[model samples]
Target chain A: MKIEVTSQMTGNVWKVVVAKGEQVEEDQEILILESMKMEIPVVSPDDGTIIELKVEEGDFVSEGDVIAILEED
Target chain B: MTKQVVEEQNELKQKIDKLLEKKEKYREMGGQKYIDAQHEKNKLTARERINLLLDEGSFKEMGILAHHQNLHPTMEGKFTPADGVVAGRGTIDGREVCVAAHDYTVLAGAIGKVAETKVARVREWSLKNRVPMIWLVDSAGVRVQESIGSLFAGNGRQFFDQVQMSGVVPLICALMGPGIAGTAYLPALADFVPMVKKTSYMALGGPHLVRSVVGEDVDEQTLGGSRVHTQESGVADLEVKSDEECLKVIKKYLSYFPSNNEQKPPIKEGVERAEITINERLAEIVPTNPKKIYNMYDVIKELSDDNDILAMKPKWAKNIITAFGRVGGYPVGFIANQPMHLGGALDGDAADKAARFMNICDSFNIPLVFLQDIPGFIVGSKVEKAGIIRHGAKMLHMVSEATVPKITIIIRKAYGAGYFVMNGRQFDPDYIAAWPTAEISVMGAEGASSILYHKQIRKAEDSKAAWSEYADQFRNLIDVEVAASNMLIDDVIDPRETKLQIFDAVASAWNKKVERPWKKNSIRPV
Candidate 1:
């Protein structure tokens, strides 16, 4: 199953923790966003392999923006 | 003299025999052929379903001999046993409940003139007696041939009765077969509807009517099947595989409610399988990092009695959690935020869901426990267009109007208007406590600081670094201790002590009563 990881808040992507094709566990932090001067981690909702990374470091994304796509194991 | 007496006894015997024969016919239920067909369709007869729903031998039927009064030549000989409905008062798990099951065997369970009257009568009885009403809806809509003029026009009383009984008593429905047109409204008004998979269907019109009116071709299942109602439309609360399972679900749902709103929910003896202890894990379960997400369910479970909680609408509007669980073996309703979803923001749907749950709990006199981890109500033009203002106001209205003892524990992130809606100090919750991790703020520190020091931060050589430093300083200002010092909250306590604190608060307010200014009721925002 393919899952879309969406940002819950508008923020600047501070770091991209996983690259495409990298396996990640549920609740694993896939990226950190700097919003309101706080570092907010966007975690994977399920254990999956990252099929696509939609955002890069320093990218500004709005709420509900898809940041990554994961293919569940 | 003896001969005359014997003759009178013989006459009485004959009359008694006739009455017994009539009852046998009523029990026959559309004869063996129709019953066999019902079995073939994997559906139970109406009485059989009621038998499974209620305690055995407890159903005292009301209108057993009622039949269609339509005396037209075509309908003259038609045998409408029990008027195609079996309604009565029964005990489920030894608690009184009123039930009406539409019998599919007789005229395909059509809601004829008499059947509608029978249902309406039972609804009235249930409402007056203040007992929960369980409707086993499986009707083929109004009997079109017999329902004309007065019969068709007077059919609306049933729906009216349903609306009247809305908050007065719990209404539960199980769709065991097709319920089209007029019959569809019963389940729609029900507080909980469990649809039987495959056999159960509900729609405003059947395939034939739809085809005739809209020129659309569709099958019954395709139009209003169990899957469609439960998943696509969310009209039904659950989809069970069989009639038996549907009844079981109804029984379980009723366990959470009292027989009526006037009484407390039935207590489960020795329900606390585990001793109430402060789990140290709760202290660390909430992350110190403000922006990190944590599973709120874990914290709820740790505090709930025996770690047992029944979450309602778990999939819908999941940012806020609404559930029924026991705290210290006393039934309490829980409203919490799931930071895992939407960063625990209150969106339109979340507000509606929580507000409705609060209303239910308040109406039933269930104590409410608010676990605050909300950031704020979602902001944006999209949400405004979605009517978040009115919906969010509904939540506030319910919380403020609720008469039941309310205990609030701010685990984390009580920010902006979310704080007030979640039973903050302004709402006058009976007891309000906050964990050390709670951040009582107007907004997140970063956003607030940027607005306050906009010019200064913009003028800094490294504006980003300057903004972060200012945000950190503002964040430290609104910690739980600061709020407690200002008397904005009751106290800042350890997370592990939450269970005990809430239990004590609820116990102290167990007999607390409020006297409101005499009025019909306050009109809540939609």
Candidate 2:
């Protein structure tokens, strides 16, 4: 079972640092979102593999949107 | 030219003669000791700190000469100014504030007979002025010499004023001395406290006093250091290396929220930093292998507002990362988990730290950001016996009751109780987004596979191999589009588009904002 990485606050998907199938540790910055002149990095929960990316660059989001999923280690 | 030079010298000599007379007058009053004490007293003056925090030339002096001179009418020339505490009014960042800085050189900054009155005056002035109060505490304790007649005096409840005003008005304490005895409680009473290391300490009593009473040798540093209060106890909000650093941190903390809940915060010019393409890099950030721990800081730095991110209690809460940062130009609260520490599990200290922070943010109406990377609450006999359940529940209550705009970005694990506490679907977060590389499941693939297919795997030709094979099947690689295609989560977002979506959601929440319609809710639930 893996955990999905989502945006904590709403913003634009400014950049996606992790690629699908790449490995990630807990608290590692997985994705970056720009909102209200701030950049928020979405991070991973466990030592896991990135399985998918949901939102694309320039897409607007609200709170609780899934940005990526991490298959647990 | 020679004649003009001679005239200038004469004027300069006259000026020097006047200075000598004034110095001699001060010397005659109580000899060099009095002069030395007075000059030394000025070194701990709040003038410098006040200037750094407030706009220049904004501080207006109040009760500067309001000392105990009235009681000793016969000794008219024996009056002291402000009784070693400089209490005054000032505009800190255009917001009105009343500040009182203790003069440490004056009898070790002991509270005098009338010192409490001066502070009370400042506190009352702040309440009347409808402004925040800043107390620069560097005192040893009460003045034992003048403690005789204080009972009859009317200033016994000065400290109580601070306590009463805690939730009523914002109180910030900057501890700049070896915080001992009573000074320790003052900071604890305030909403926020920023302390300087080595120079600052907070203790109910010095270790020597405690040791004397208990017959144990307790060292001072071990008893009341910045590390103990900020890291272990969570008494102080911020621990800075120097006095200057402490002042700067105080300014930054006050910048985010409004002066009070009744008002909206002033939107300052937004931060300007080099914008990097952080969203586009998310695809390669989270690893495909479930076991490898990727760098969450990279995503945090990318998603953070330029240089607005300031992580707090970093050493204590290794699992949950709590920070103070800004969105646009307004201050907001940021909480995330780091899988690197205890697999991003919530512990007792981390929960307490985040809970208190959540209370403050929610009370002040600051929006919350949850970086959900939590496996679950820490289990095991040690954690349970240590009261992890009660402490973890505190964090849950704070998050759920927080009425401010909340957004949850689940970057990785959100299993069990950690899911709900992190503002999952149950909390009804304003916006919920997930990345394409998400596996929304409980526990983990390894545990799930063992529980579900243990008997079947044992029957296989190779039991151990079958277990591993079954675990792999539960992995995201085995089924990529299962959760998203089913629409279990609201939407799956690309890493690059995450920022834009968060902004939109916050905007939507802002637009849909409806404050508590009742009489501002009577009680403050802890």
The best candidate by TM-score is: 1
lDDT of 1 by residue, B273-330 (tens): 3455667989888888765667898988888876778776665566888888887777
Per-model TM against the reference = 0.84, 0.74
After superposition, candidate 1 runs with Cα above 4 Å error: A1-73, B1-4, B36-42, B72-77, B149-151, B197-201, B205-235, B239-241, B271-274, B457-463
Residue A65 C-alpha lDDT in model 1: 98
Highest DockQ, which number? 1
**lDDT per residue as tens, model 2, B1-526:** 6999999999999999997776444223223464466455333344456667777898786655445544444434543445667678877677778888876645566777677777888899877666778888877777655654655364447677776676556778988776678778888888778777667777887877888888767666567767667656778776777777877877777777677766655555754323333466766777765555555666666675664577666645666777777655546678887765555668787788788778777767777888776777877787798888888888888877788788877777777788787888678688877776655567667778999998998789988889888888877442324655776556777767666666666656763465555665544333
Global lDDT for candidate 1? 0.85
Model 2 achieves a DockQ score of 0.02
| Candidate RMSDs in order | 5.0, 13.0
Worst 10-residue stretch by lDDT in candidate 2 chain B? B23-32
User: Which residue pairs show collisions in model 1?
Assistant: A36-B446
